[model samples]
Target: MNILITGSTGMVGKNLINHNNAKEYSISGPSSKEINLLDKSKILDWLAKNPTDLIIHCAGLVGGIQANINNQSGFLFNNLQMGINLIDAAYKSGIRNFINLGSSCIYPKNISNEIDESMLLSGKLEETNEGYAIAKISVAKYCQFLSEKGFNYKTIIPCNIYGKYDDFSETGSHMIPGVIARMHKAKINNDNYIEIWGDGKARREFMYAEDLADAIWFCVKNIKQIPKFINVGIGEDFSIKDYYQTISEIVGFKGEFKFNRTKPVGMKRKLICSKIINQLGWMPKFSLNKGISYTYNYYTKEIQN
Candidate 1:
């Protein structure tokens, strides 16, 4: 099968392209300067280059809460344009098997702590990333509409992804990567304290990016009637305060972290109630501590090597 992935340079995409265990498939992404999702015409032209059988829509404008707040227009516009353009082009080109990547933030704020797929669009989203959330929701709707029209597309929403090849760059990284960078710097400098956002009361669910890649390939290979949409997560819950302690331990930063109440602490916690995928006999294998350790080791060696 010929496969294409978008957002190939980002954390999730980088991990997926490298971790995909599927052997007999051809894979391509944006880094080759082949497909720029921002330009609709470019999307069409790129799609024509290959009679691809499948597309992993992993491309989008994504970042931490700060980036979302500081660049709402760019976040919302670019991501919306990319999703609509690519999905429509895939449909027009007769590529039925498309995967629309989504985020857990699309779920409503009042969603039960352990959120479910059915809870989407049931309430308002967290305001900090509402624009980004709406774009993801649109993709979900687009996939469902296409499926109803007899197209075979699927949208899989993942929560708090982390692991190898994360963007440690100052502007692009998310919470996990951000924390890793901060804690690592602190460790190197022998600092005594790290600063975190809000009251450190918020909870989040995290999955290693490689484990998510595994789940994606599993879905592609095993499921025929891809439930239109599904949730991907570790089915575990953790708080930011606990996370800081964990990262501190992993990086050996014996410092205390101050909770900055002024900053936004997205949702209290977002644990995807992925009973559907779990019932299909899939579960995340990496614990947060171990995943953090490996990620730290990666950046450490990246600096050393």
Candidate 2:
């Protein structure tokens, strides 16, 4: 099974490649020179030329809350184009077995504990990431529509994935990497306190990237009885304040946290339930502490250089 992955350098894509099973899988991680996603001609041409059996789309302009707020147009346009182009090309070229990865941000902001797959598009999305959320919704629905039309494709909505290969840059990284970077920088600079956004009251679900990869492989291998769209998460959540405290402790950031009430937190609470995926015998195995520590080490060792 030769799998085509677009965003090989991203956090999730990096974990998907670095896993031991990935070495066994016939996977191709083409650099930008191979196929620019926005270049429709290039993407279609590449699909027609390359004989790929599967396409695990991991590309797009992804960022955290602040990044989303700053670059709404880029997020919406890039993600929409990437999703539309990849799926259209793959479908037209007669390639099936597609796996589209979407964010939990697609869920409505007010969704309470254990968000089901059906709750999508039911309410207003978090304003901070509304553009990104809308783009993700389109992608997910695109896959779902194709699935309904008898395409052998699936979409996995993972919640707040973080691990090795994550962007440690403060401005563009997600919560986990961003927090780790902040903690590391604070520790190095001997800063007194760390600033958190939106009062640190919101809750979120997180899954290790490696665990997400495991779940992806599990779904790919067992596509039988799979839903058109499924939620991939740890089935648990933690408040942002608690998450910051944990990361601070792991990175040895001995400082107080200052919450800025003026900033806008994306979702009040978002955690996806894996009842559908779990019933098929797939599960994620990483505690918040362990994943944060592993990711912190990776960022400090590989990225901080």
Candidate 3:
């Protein structure tokens, strides 16, 4: 099988390429410079010229809570265009096997317990990432609609993912990377204390990038065996304060933490139920402590350079 993976330079895409040990498949990961996702003409042209059998659409306009809140329209328009164009072009080019990467944020905001796949679009979405959530929902709906026409496509909704190669910008990175960068910077700068958003009570589920990569590989090989949409995660969660303490310890940050009561904490408890994917014999390997340690080391050595 000849597979094409978009967002090759991203955390998940990079890990996917690295963890793929199968000897039978040929994988190609195109950089943004080589294939601009927003340009539908370029996507179609590339697909026509390059014969690909499978496509793992990982490219999108992704960012953290602050970034999402700041660039709501950009998140919506850019992500929507990318998914719509890539999948449609692939389908037109005779590519049947497709795996679309989605976020758990598509679940309703009022979720107080374990989130199920059936609960999608059941209610309102988190205000902080409503635009991005809407974009993901559109992609899933598109794939679901196309499946009725004999398209072998499905969407995988993964919980909060973090690891090496993640965006660490203060304004653009997700929760884990943002916390790592801030604590690392504060430790080096010898700051007395660091401030965190919200009261540190909300809980979240996290999956390592390498684990997600492995799961994607599993799905591609077993695409025909899986359902139209599935959730891939560790099936566990922790509080914000626990994350702060853990990250601080991993980054060697001794500074005190100050919780900002005014800042927004998107969801009270956003935990996904990975029972379906688990039943398929796929599971995450990295524990939170181990993943944080490995990611922090990577950040200090590679990203800090």
Candidate 4:
């Protein structure tokens, strides 16, 4: 099948493109400069010329907690606009298969339990990333509305992901990559200590990006059987301190970590229920340590050099 993966240069998109099964189909991964999703006309024009049969919508404005807090408006507006434009263009172009990527952040903030797909928007979102969550929820709802009308658009909500091509910048990266970068720098500079935001007690479920790519491909092969919304995750979680310890081990950082209680830790816990996807015969291949090791290796080889 002919497939178009938005945000092809992103960590997730790049992983999907590099998946072994990707060779079985014709896939187009256009850069933002090649096809700007913020513009509807540009999307429609691209579809008109590309003749795509499926779309894996992975494009969005995403970042860590500080970035989310500082750029709430940009996150909401850009993400919402990009999703709407792409989905609308896909509809107009008669494309039936679409796989929209959603984050675990879409679940309510107060729920400390393993989040299921049904609990989406059940309560207030965590204040730190509420804008981004709202945008993701809105787009997922849009896809659901279209799915009810017979289109095969579906949303796959994955937990925190880190792997090759992850954003490891100081202010623009998620927990895993951010920690990796910080710890690596501290190790390199022979810093005696590293500071962690919050009390380092909040829990999170993170999967390797390549594992998410495998799940997406599984969804592609079983598109008709996939639900309107499904959760794809590692079915496990770790405290911030635990993650710090693990990543430190991988990065060979021997420094002590100090916690800053004043920093905003978005949610106390955000672990999603991956029962449906699990039953669908899809499971993540990497453990937390294993994934971090791979990601750290990628960091050293790709980003550090």
- Please tell me which predicted candidate would have the highest TM-score against the true structure: 4
- 3 or 4, which is superior by lDDT? 4
Sorted on lDDT, best first, the list reads: 4, 3, 2, 1
Query: For candidate 3, lDDT tens digit of each residue in 70-102?
Result: 999999999999999898888888888899999
Candidate 1, residue 283: how far the Cα is off, in Å? 1.4
* Alpha carbon lDDT of each predicted model: 0.84, 0.86, 0.91, 0.93
RMSD, every candidate, angstroms = 1.4, 1.2, 1.1, 0.8
lDDT of 2 by residue, 10-94 (tens): 7778888888778767888888788999877898898777789999988889888888888888899999998998898888888
TM per candidate: 0.96, 0.97, 0.97, 0.99
User: Which of the predicted structures, 1 or 3, would earn the higher TM-score when compared with the native?
Assistant: 3
- The lowest-lDDT stretch of 10 consecutive residues in candidate 4 is 104-113
Give the distance in Å from residue 246's predicted Cα in candidate 1 to where it truly belongs. 0.6
Candidate 3 ranges with C-alpha deviation above 4 Å: none
- The backbone clash count of each candidate, in order, is 4, 0, 0, 0
Error of 1 at 123 (Å): 0.4
lDDT of 4 by residue, 1-305 (tens): 99999999899999999999999999999989889999999999999999898999999999999999999999999999999999999988899999999998888886878899999877888989888999999999999999999999999999999999999998889989999999999999999999998999899899999999999999999999989999999999899999999998889999999999988988899899999999989988999889999999999999988
Model 1 TM = 0.96
